[model samples]
Target: MTEVSRTRPTEIGLPGPTPRDMLRSMRFISREPLAFLGRMAAEHGDTVAFPIPGPPVLLVNDPADVQRVLRTGGRSWSKQTVQYAAFARVTGPGLLAADGPTWLAHRRVAAPAFHHERIEALGGLVGEAVDDAVAARLRTPAFASGDVADLAELCHHVGLDVVGRTLFSVDLTGQAAELLRTTGSAAELVVRQGRSLVSTLAWAPTPTNLRLLAARRRLARATAGLVAQRRDAVGPGAASYGDDLLGLLLDSDLTDEQVGDELVTMVIAGHETVASALSWTLMLLAEHPAAQDRLRAEVAAAGEVSFLRHREALPFTRAVVDEALRLFPPAWVVSRRAREDDHLAGRDVPAGTLAIISPWLVQRRAEDWPDPEAFDPGRFADGATQRPAYLPFGAGPRLCIGRELALAEMVVVLARLLGEFRVSLPPGYVRPAPETLAAVQPEGGMPLVVTRA
Candidate 1:
């Protein structure tokens, strides 16, 4: 670990590390990214430099510094990192993978679908999806027998179904399982490739890469099929597009390939992150019975309709979601490559340098969060303090467009689930370690015993 210096450098300073240390850091980053970044921030202060080959890699943990890199200096940076390069294989030149004009154009076309009015109207769809999942679980012998259920798996199904219904006006519950597995495998491959020293491994015809290729092909075919179906439904003389995101993209100037990429990106982004957030929130609530009891009581009193109608009145429920996001942010790390020379928190950052801002580290900083490790929903009772520091969905022009929908899904699904069942971790069960694949997810599924409330 790099030691913290007593005097902060006024200009950009690279904490020179021996070649051995640089190799060790790379290994740590690849093997355990969360631990490596946490240790770096703890031992080397908010800003730490790694003497890696090519451009310097810096991890900025300071909230101000993170803001500078993500917002103020955003125009001077691009998503041209090796990490994003690996992501582009599966995501293509979609909004998540694209930068500059391409990103702006996609964002503009798809923006209206995620508007507050549209999202609010989709509440009923989200509610129906959650109810369907609950009904399916209740039909299973596991619920009747009182056997442990994997809430994480259940949430993924619900998330996928919700995303499908809301975005494409189609129910994907039938294909959710396959989609989840394929996307997971492809995303894990990308993460591995991103961390590898050899960038070509991502494109190599290795078994993993082959699987990723197959997954991409499958996803593209699935999306293209949906696009065709929607187009046919509209008829030749009818409007080219509907109000949905898929409709907007098809109606836009983007090519069919670009439309497919954006659809795939939305499916993966829309479902996975929300599912991860819901899973973690359940795990946290299960661990904290008192909070669970309060939430249950609140849900019972308010009812399902109120989750959307009277959202602001349910501060505690929202806080629980916020706190969970703080501890287990799905998009744990945001990576960017400097496009031009920039200064970050009084330090000079050279063009082409890789800058990483980890919400997991920033949110958990002791200075920003008191008793950072503890699950305290009260911290968010009054809403997020230090806005830049609490970047679960990110900040700036590139902030996640689907954040509102994600939050609404989590709150509604959690309310419906907790209102009906009492969730408890299985006895002698070990907590799953956090793993970064597409998003921060539990290593093993979150297995918990669920009983009717």
Candidate 2:
């Protein structure tokens, strides 16, 4: 066997980075998540082991291995305790981090909001938000831009608006900017705390905890206020949106705290991912004019870019969104732990071991994707490649309950933007990778130059 083949399962594995290098990697994750992960993948092949954590934590980059751990053999794995603990503190048993019966319950409750038919119905709302966002950008004279519109922020606002209007019957557009700041800060704080084994010891009298508590209070207040308003408006029929997520959740016997948790989790998880996907779609389109032309033609042929209409007309737009997601998956890494002793992709995983399945790596693995780095949406169209390798929304029973909603939202937003705006990267702009908290967002936000198409 080759040296790499023989040493693949070693505990320390490869020449691991030193303490300084480790710190640098951590900082890079905080500043440039996607790039740091890509660097790690390059240095170590499909499965790389890190020295931290009680046992060696394996970063699985191969798609087949990813599927084995996340779906095909999920029974052997569970969400990392670290994540569940941190997320539970804020969400109180919400779906994003919950496991077992609790997660299953939350999934059932929130599933309706994301049903394909229901999500399709919400297309008009998505189209309207995207159109308004694009129009806001268009107000800036073409080429007269100095920070015209932050696509990241715009998409965040669009997502918040969609969730509010469709789910809670609220107008969150006004609060979008504030919510963005508050949630982003809270998520970063949570991640910092979760990363350390000694975090709980330091939680007392620490500024991070103090800030985290304050942020949680603010988020809780906002969520409670919205829930109260929705409850009063609906009257006893709390969980009753024909297909709204909140209504289905209300149908369950979960406490108000649980409701608050789920609402905030959805607010944070749902929109940001789709927004990132949309932002990357724009970035990819600007980088490849040919793909953009094909998208524009496909969208133009569709009827009006209206959400309610043109369901069957925009395959290229959907393809572009899917491709962008595959390249820069917003939820880049999924953290899980082995619930029982399990062997995955030829490695023995003891119980309580952390397993990181990253679509960011798997989707672009040299072995899985041909011309892996190329910006080609057509690869996803019909039968050009294996579909299992793509897990942007995750896989298995725990797959994102909001996947359908997210995709519909992306397609509608991209179609509208392509139809109305000539989107491109601002001149001299360098596309930054991302700093992931809850989702991967451009570090300083995506500043793009816009013009009426």
lDDT string for model 2 (1-453, tens) is 011211233564333344445654565555554565666677666676765747657777776677777784347888756755776666667888888777877777777676667665677777677776666655545534334467777787788788886676567877787787788888787777665432274358689878888888888999988777767777874446334666666667888888899998977787778777877778788778788888888877766654433435676777777788888888877778888887765767777777776688788877767998888777877623337788888887778877767777878777777776666777787986566666766778877766567
| Model 1 misplacement above 4 A | 1-12, 25-27, 201-203, 304-310
Per-model TM against the reference: 0.94, 0.88
Give the Cα-based TM-score of candidate 1 against the true structure.
0.94
- Cα RMSD of all models vs. native, in order, equals 2.5, 4.0
For all candidates, what are the clash counts?
0, 1
lDDT of 1 by residue, 72-103 (tens): 53488888888888888898989888988888
Candidate with maximal TM-score: 1
lDDT of 2 at 194: 62
* Worst lDDT 10-window in candidate 2: 1-10
* Least accurate 10 contiguous residues by lDDT in model 1: 2-11
